[model samples]
Target: MADDKYYTLAEGCPFANNASAVLMRGKQGSGLGLLQDTQLIETLAHFSRERIPERVVHAKAVGSYGEFEATRDCSDFTSASFLNKVGKKTPVLQRVSTVGPESGSADTSRDVHGWAMKFYTDEGNQDFVFNNTPVFFIRDPLKFPSLNRSHKRHPQTHLPDANMFWDFHVGNPEGIHQLLILFSDRGTPKSVRYMHSYSGHTYKFTKPDGSFKYAKIHVKTQQGVENLSSQEATRIAGEDPDFMIRDMFEAIERGEYPTWNIYVQLMSPEEAENYKWNIFDMTKVWSHTEFPLQQIGRLTMNRNPQNYFADIEQAAFSPSTMVPGIAASADPVLQARLFAYPDAARYRLGVNYQQLPTNAAKAQVYCPFQRDGAMRFDDNYGGDPNYVGSWIKPTKFYQDAKGIRASALALHTDHEKWVGEVSAYTSEITDDDFVQPAALWEVLGRVSGQQDRVIENLVGSLTGVKYPELRRAVYSLFGRVNNNLGFMLQERTEAVIKTVQN
Candidate 1:
C-alpha cells in the first residue's frame, strides 16, 4: 500500500517512486534529460508560464482572508443582506496596495494605498474598491489616464519624473487636498493594519421601498492609526522593502488577527440637494460634524492565504460588483470605475476571471447570458437555456428584501434628474477647492512639528523637479491653499535647489 500523501505528478501518477528528476546521467554525473521524460518536460513548461500580467497600478500588495460581522442592524439604511442583522457574518477578502509602485517596489513607498475589499454575501459579491484617503487627485473621469500616467514612469526616460508629476498637479490643482494628505505623515502608513480605508466616492445605501441615502464608507483600524516618518519610511524601504507585508503575516500567524470597525456617514437625498459642496465630488469629504459616522460592522482578518498566487494574485475586485441593496452614485469618477475596473480585470485575468475560486461568488450564480470565454472550467450552464424568457427553463431573478423583483426596480433616481442639454464638461479649480486643504494645514498645526514635516516631505520631492517654473506653479497652487504653506514650500524648496547647485 502507498501513502496517499506521497508526492506525485500533476496528474496524480507516482514519479517512479523517486523524487529525483529523470535525467540521463553520464559516468561523471553530467546529466541531460530527454524530451521523453514527461515530468521534466511538464515541470519546465509550467515554470516558464508561471507568471501572469501584473496589475498596471497597485502591483505591490498584501492580502488576507477575513470575516465581516455586522455589529449593528443596518436594515434601515441598506437592504444588503450582509448588514441586515446584528451578528451576521460574511466572508471577505481584502487587498492593500501602494498605487504608484511596481510589484517589486518597496512597501514603504510614499504613495496612496489602495484598500479594496470583497464581501461574499448571501446575495452576491459586494466589493468596495476604496483608498486609505477620503479624497482623490481628480474628480473628472477624463483626467484619469493623465493622472495615472503622470505619476508613472516617463515614456521618454522610463524613469519616475518629478517634472511630470508636478506639471500634472499644477495644471489640475483640484488635487491639492489629497496632495497635502499625501505629503503628510499619513502617506507613510506603519502597516496595512494601522491605516483607515475610505470610500472616496459617495455610494447609495438603498432600501427595498425605492428609497436611498448617500453614504461614504469608512473602515477604521482597531489597532489604531500609526505612521512612519519620512526618514524612517525611507530607511525601512532600504533595509526591508517587505516590512509591511511581513508585519501583517507574522501578526496573523501569532493569532493576533487585525480588526477594523466599519462605519458609514449617511446623508439624506434632501440634504444632498442643498449640500454646500458637491456630494459627488471625490475631491471633497463629507463634514464629519454634520454627518457623523454610524456603526455598521466589524472586520477581522484571521486567515492567511495558503498560496499567494492562487488566492491574492488572481482575486479580482471592482466597485461594480454590488448586490441588491447597494448601488453606485452618479459621481463621474465612480461611474467611470464601474466599467474600468472590471474591464481591466478581464484584460489582466481572462474573460472567465470571475469563475476563479478567489473571485467566484459564494452565493449561487446563474447568469447564463455571461456564459462562455477562454479558461471557463465551469459547467457553462450545461443543458439549461442560455437565453432568458424561455418557458422550458426560465431563469429566476433575485428579489429585494421587500420581495420586489430586482428587475422591476426603477432605473432612475432623483439625483439623475438633470434637465440641462448634454455638453462637454471639465471641472475648474476655484477658491472652494483650496478651502479644505487650508483647513487641513491648520489641522496639521495642532500636532507639534507636523506642518514642518509636511513641508520637508514636499521639499524632498519638489526639489527633484529640474524645471524652476514648474516648481513655482506648484508653489502657487499650494499658496492658494494657504499663504504660509506656499511661502515655506517655495523658500525651503528653492534653498535646497540652490544648495545642490552650489
Candidate 2:
C-alpha cells in the first residue's frame, strides 16, 4: 500500500513527483523561480482551506478513544443491541469540553463542562451529549440562545458582565436550580476525568414489545469527583491555561487510564405518571432516594487521540443519534438539541458530515435517499432508486426492521399517547422548584463548611454587581431556597462591596 511506503496526496498520487517547487537552477543551487509546481499549489491551497468552523459551544476540547463494556443485562427494559447482552464491548470516542469558551480560552474556567461520547454499536452510533450537572438552567427551548448570550460578553462593553448574568437568571428564575450549582465549588472541576457526567434529560429504554422505562444516565468518575476552589481555579487559569487537557493527556501516556461507571435511574411508565415531579423537565432531577441507580456499564479511556483535528475536531455528537431501543424524551432542551446539534454539524462539516471517519457509524448504512451533498465521497448507493416504494428496484428498508417492535394495544397507549403527553407538557417555576436546591443545600451542610464555601464563592461574584437593586434581587433569589442562607449572602456580599469601594 502507498500508506506503508511513503507520502501521497488526497488522491493516491505519490508525493515524490513534486517535493519542492519546479525552478531554474541558480549558481548557489538555490532554485530561482517556479515554472511548474502543481503539488506546491495543491499543498498551499489545501492548507489555506483546511480550517472549518469551530463549534458554537465546546470548542476547546480533549478527546480519547475508549470502550464501554456492558456489566449487566438490560434486555428486560431495553432491546438496544449494545445493552441486550452482558459483557458486550462497544468502541467509543469521548470528548470533554468547556462551554461558553473559545478554543484559546483557559481550560479551568468556571463554566459548564460538556461530556460527549459516541458509541459504535452494531446497530449504529449512539451519541450521549451530556453535562457535568444533572440539571439545566431552563426547560423551555426558546430561551436557549438568550441564555447563552447572557453568559457571554455584554453587547456594548464586549466584556463579561455580572449584571447580564444575574439579569438573565433573575428574569427567568426557572434556572435557579442550575444557577445554585453553577455558583458552587462544583463549578470549577479540577480535571475532566475527576468530574462526573449526567444526562440531564430523561430518555427511554424500550423492549421489543414496545414496553419501555424512563432512564437518566449517570457516569460517576471512578477517580472520584474532585474540584478546585475559586482561588485555585483562578490561579490555574493564569498559570496553565491547558492544565486539564495536559493532565488527561499525560495520564493516558503514563498508563493511568481513567474510568467511569455508567449507571441509570429508571422508572416504569406507570411510576412516571404518578411521580410528583414531571419526568420531562430538564431543570429537575429524579431523586436518588426515589429512583436508585442501576449499574449498566463501565467506560475506560485508555488511548489518546493520534491527530487532534481528525479525531476530536471533526467529531460531531447529538442526543438525536440513537440506536434501536434507545430514544429521546420530550424534554424541550433535549428535543431542541436533537435538531440543533446535527444542523450545526451540517453547516460546519457539510451535509455529508456523518461520512467523516470520526462521526461515521461502524455498522453498515444503506440509505440511498441521503446522497449527493458537498464533500460526499461515497458511490451514491450504486445506482439504487432514491425514491421509496419503487417497483422497478425494490429497495430494502433495514432500519424499519431494527426499530422498536410493538403489539397492537401497546402501539396506541404507551407508544402514541405517551409521546403526545410528554411533548405537550409545559414547565413552570414555583416554590416547588426550590425543593431540589434545598435538598442539595442540606447535602452540602453534611460536608461541614461546604455550604460556607459555596456562599463565599457566590458572594465573590454577586458583590461585583454594579447595581444595588440587582445585587438585592440576586440575594432574594438565593434566599428563597433557604431564609438563613439568603440573609448570609446579602450580609457577606454587601461587606465585600463596601471593602472594595473603600
Candidate 3:
C-alpha cells in the first residue's frame, strides 16, 4: 500500500511503522522499560550533546550573511585578492555584540560593543575582529586579564559592581579616551545598523612585492548614527532585553538590509616612524586629518543566520586569521589577542575547532603539519607526513625574492630598548591623559543637559566605591580632566552619600 503522507521518522527515515507506541506497565500502573526502547534513549542522547560552549566574551551576538564589495581600487595599499579589483564582491558574515555581558543580558547595555566580521574569500578567511569605538582601554598586553576582570562581575559579590569597573578605569588612566566615548551616547546605540565599526588596532596591508602599508579600517553605517538616552535604554532593557537582535533580524526579513561604507586610513612605513602618537597605543586615535579615509568598499548585511546555534554560536573569529596581504602590527593588545582569541576558541570549542562548519576556511588550507587533534573531522592528511623533515615528501612555499628580502630586512632592525621592572600592569593618571577628557567635557556642554547628565552619572558611580583612597584617586583623575568638574563630583557625591548615611 502507498503511504498517505511522506513516510518519515524524526531523522527523515522512511519508517513503515513506529512499533512499541504503547507503554508497558505493571499491575500497579507503574513500569520500567527495558533496553528495547531505542527512540527515547536516542532522543535524550542527541539533546544532551547539542550545545557547544558559548563565547566568554561577545557571547550575546547577532550574525548575518552579507557581501563586501570593493568600491574603489586600493592596489597601492594591499594585495589582498578580495580587494584586487573594484566591484569585487566577497561573502561575509558579520557579528555585532555587547562585550562583558553574558548571553542573556540586555543588548542595550552601556558597554563596549564587538564588531567582528569574517570574510570568506578565495584566498582564505580574513577576520576583522574589531570594536565599535576607534580606541580601547589598555595598550599593554599584560593588562588584558585585569581589564577584563574589572569589567566582569566581582569574584566575591558575583554582581555587576560599578566600583570594580571604576577603580580599574581610574587606575588605568590610559583608558581615558575610551572611557569618555563609552560613557557617551555612542555606547547605547539604538540599533546595530546605526553603529559604526572600527579597526581600533593598526594592521599591516602588504603588497605582493613585500612592501606594506599600515591601515586602519572604518565601517560607517549608511543608516546614520542613532543613539538611545539612558532612560530609554533602561526602559528598553526591562521591556525587551533582545531589542537590538530582534531589530536586526526583522529589518533583514522585511528586505530593509543595512549597508556600511567601508573606508581605510593608510599610513606609509616612513610616516609611521615619525607619527606623534604611538601607532601601537590602543588608547590613542590616529589623526583623521593627517591620514584621511580612502573609500575602498561597502558591506551590506542582506540575510540573517538561518539557525542561531549552527551559524552564529559556533562561529569562531580570531585576529590571527589573516590572508596573504593582511597582517598584524606590533600593537601589544593586538599581539595579545592574536594568541588569546584562538586559545579561548580552542578551549570553548575543541582543539580541532577549526574543523567546525562555521569556523572552517574556504581557501585551500594545506597544513598537514597541524593534523591529528581531538575531533579532527578532516582527512587528517591521509597517509601523508604530519611532521616536518620527511625525506619522502617536501614542503613547498610560494615565496618570491622580495618576500625573502623583506624577511631579512625585518630581522635586521636594531630596535634595542631597555627592559624595565615587570610588575602587574597599571596606568597612573597624568597630564597627557586628562587632555582628551577635558576636551570631551567641553564638547559635551554643547549638547544641552548632556554635560550635567555626565557629571551626575559620574558622581553616582563614584559614590559607590568602597575604598576612600580609590575614591579620592578617582576624583583626582577627574580633577585633572577638569578642576571644576572634579569639585562638582566631590560636592555632589558627598551630599548624596551623607543623605544615604543619615
TM-score for each prediction? 0.94, 0.90, 0.89
- lDDT against the true structure, per candidate, is 0.90, 0.87, 0.82
User: On residues 1-502, what C-alpha lDDT tens digit does candidate 3 reach at each position?
Assistant: 4656765557776655555433479899867775655665666678998877777778888789899999887777777889989999999998999999899999998888999999998888999999999989888878877888888899998998878998888778888778777877787899899999999999988876667888899999999999898789889999999999999999999999999999999999889889887788777778789999888999999988988877888788999988778888888789889999889988988888888887788876666668887888878878654555445323322223213112321222222244689777554545766666677889878988876776776776777877778877877777887898778878898888889889
Model 2 regions lying over 4 Å from their true place: 1-36, 390-414, 418-427
The number of clashing residue pairs in each candidate reads: 0, 0, 0
Error of 2 at 414 (Å): 5.8
Please provide, for model 2 over 97-129, each residue's C-alpha lDDT reduced to its tens digit, 9 standing for 90 to 100: 998888888989889899999999988899999
Local error of candidate 3 at 421, Å?
A: 12
Question: What TM-score does structure 2 among the candidates reach?
Answer: 0.90
Ten residues in sequence with the least summed lDDT for candidate 3: 401-410
Model 3 pairs whose backbones collide = none
- Which candidate tops TM-score? 1
Task: Record all residue pairs in model 2 with backbone atoms less than 3 Å apart, i.e. clashing.
Answer: none
Off by over 4 Å in 3: 1-23, 28-30, 389-429
Clashes of 1: 0
User: By how many angstroms RMSD does model 3 differ from the true structure?
Assistant: 4.5
Ranking by TM-score: 1, 2, 3
lDDT of 1 by residue, 1-502 (tens): 4666776789988776455576789998979978878887788899999989999999999999999999999888787889989999999999999998899899999999999999999888999999999999999999988998999999999999999999999999899999999999999999998999999999999876778989999999999999999999999999999998899999999999999999999999899999999999999998999999998999999899998998999999999999877999989999999999899999999899999999999997767678878988988977654666445434443222224243433243443466677888779988999888889999999989999999999999999999998999998898888898899999999999999999
